[model samples]
Target: MIRASNVVYSYLKYGRTGEEPVSVRALDHVDLEIERGSFISIIGHNGSGKSTLAKHFNGLLFPKEGTVWIDDLPTDGKGNLAQIRQKVCMVFQNPDNQIIGATVEEDIAFGLENMQVPTEQMQERIDRSLEAVGLTEKRNENPGCLSGGQKQKTAIAGAVAVSPQCLVLDEATAMLDPRARREVIRVARKLNEEEGITVILITHFMDEIIHSHRIFVMDHGVVVQSGTPKEIFADPGLLEQYHLELPPVTKLAFGLRQKGLPLELPVLEPEELLKQLLRIRKGGGAC
Candidate 1:
């Protein structure tokens, strides 16, 4: 559903008092692709260009060089901008920053209003989106008055109300507590599984991405590794080189395997680790 080729983006850094503006490259020759109806994640440490690349998905920021295409439309084409944006919608890190309307229903309606969707169709979309996000009961509440997770769901509902084909969640769960983070992730997973919307989640939390079909690891503005979650986690040293780490359960499994416990290299969940231990116990192996 999305493709980028040799994409390069730079930010102009201005020095104090009339010095030359330095061109700092944020994305350097990055190339990646996302398939329709798949859940994928982009992970990196700070300054890794994850968010910069996401902006290209919806044309929030055009690449300084190369190209980004949503569906078959080039993002650089002025005439295609509108359609590209409609095809791909984004939910950023801060719900406070994204939420505009006072109430949940109104915030959702904001996007449809901007698109000039007919009144009947707009309400129908709003109700459907709210139900999808599990926020139907809170639709009348003020967004600010809701929990952080709820506010983010409102933001997601806003994006869904537009009927976007792809959802780019740029650090959408960064601010929430663990429970809230899981809530947000659950909503994203539901949307991907049931609605078949392509999901591109940009997050540093390794555990949050365990179920993703694919992962793109970025460093120094480049895609250093791209593979399934297990394939990426199987090499902890590679993640360390990029200032990333394995999920907690995987980390413990890695430590055990290193100490000659014969555990698996990358155990994604605690239950998986326990199952492996049970098998070892049945075989009379040391735990």
Candidate 2:
């Protein structure tokens, strides 16, 4: 659904007049492809350039040296800009920054209004979008009155109201508590599973990546590792080198393995760990 070829982007810091501008490279010759209808998570420490890559997916930032193509349309062209944005939408970290309208339904309809969606169909889309995010009851409520999780859901409803084919979430759960984070993630999973929207989620939390179909690990503005969550978590040395933590269950399994207990290499979830323990007991290998 999306492809980047040798893409490089730099930001110029302006100096006083007659002085040379300083250029800071944000993305350096990065190449990536996101399959249609797949859930992909990107993880990296701070300043790894993962967020920069997400912006390119929605034409928020065009590459200076290379090219970005969305559904076979070049992103840099003026004529293709609208189509590219329509195909991919972005949800940022702060709900306050994204929410605009006075009421929940109005905020959800903001995107469709910008797209010039017909007034007759706008109400239908707004209603359905609010329903999809489970915010229908709050349609007339002011967004500020909602909780953090509800605000995030409102942001998501706004994005989905346009019926975009892809969703890019850049640290969308960073500021929320654990409960709110899980709520946002559940909404994201539902969108991908039920709505068939391709999802590219960028986050620093290891637990969030456990359910992803695939993961891409970034380091110093480059993709150092890319694999399924199981493969990536199984290698402790690699995770340490990348400054990443293993999922809680995986860490427990690793600790058991260190004590001479035969355990699976990557126990991604609690249920998987429980099943492995049951098999071990049945095979007379119980610790």
Candidate 3:
């Protein structure tokens, strides 16, 4: 499990030498616990502390005032920092920025190489990682040559090669087109569902968050709300307060609900909205 207790983080404002540095709190006494085999999505606008919290998951940043622990290991300590990172892998936004290897297979092997996996087991690890991300055919291709979604998949493969217990994705699909976005989401879900990797997806996209096991809404350096997608979407005012809109189909359902049609709210899927409409029509306006 990932545990953070009253964690606080701050960064100094950069300016000319003459200017005194002022501390700006990015995460304000945040307390969070992410369980094993769970898929959690954190949603917030720019600078809401979501990215900062992601960094602490793998010990990239230590809390200024509180504590962050990955499993039984404390992130504030130095003894197990490398092991903590292996247990909590992070995939950042923009596949272009994450790229390192000359080829897809090489990228997957890079971490394993650094960790010094035996040469005899290298090909097996690379092949399995590529297969998991459905990039086996492109193993020989350069990572920069792939589409945005494929490139992100390559990044994911690299993380999985280490078999981390938790995967933190900080807007991994933000750079992809709609089609590519869906593809990346599918792969993320597969990792969570099939491999039981605790997946933490941080994004502002409402559509991608609906299917998560739980959703956390952050604003102004605090987690304003958190619950299942159904519960989170049940309150339109809460979403509005955070400058978030429901998925387009869900928003349409809410509008219809307000217009004398009793459509169920927080409709997670378009088919669900369609089914509600069909049932209402079949029942002659019955709720």
TM-score of each: 0.98, 0.95, 0.97
Put down candidate 1 lDDT per residue, 50-85, tens digits, no spaces.
999998998889989998988788899688888888
Clashing residue pair totals per candidate (backbone < 3 A): 0, 0, 0
**Any runs in candidate 3 off by more than 4 Å, and if so which?**
none
Which candidate wins on TM-score? Answer: 1
Model 3 poorest 10 in a row by lDDT:
244-253
lDDT of 1: 0.93
Q: Please give the CA lDDT of all the candidate structures.
A: 0.93, 0.90, 0.90
Model 3 C-alpha lDDT per residue in residues 1-287, reported as the tens digit of each score: 99999999999997888999999999998998888999999998899999999999998899998899888899986788889989999998989988899999888889999888898898998888788888999999999999999999999999999989999999998998999899888888998999899999998788998889999889888988989999999988888998888877778888888888988677889889889889999998955
Top-scoring candidate (lDDT): 1
lDDT of 2 by residue, 165-274 (tens): 99998999998999999999999999999999999999988888899988999887788888999889979899899888998889999998788778878888989888
Model 1's TM-score against the true structure: 0.98
For model 2, the local distance difference test gives 0.90
Error of 1 at 40 (Å): 0.6
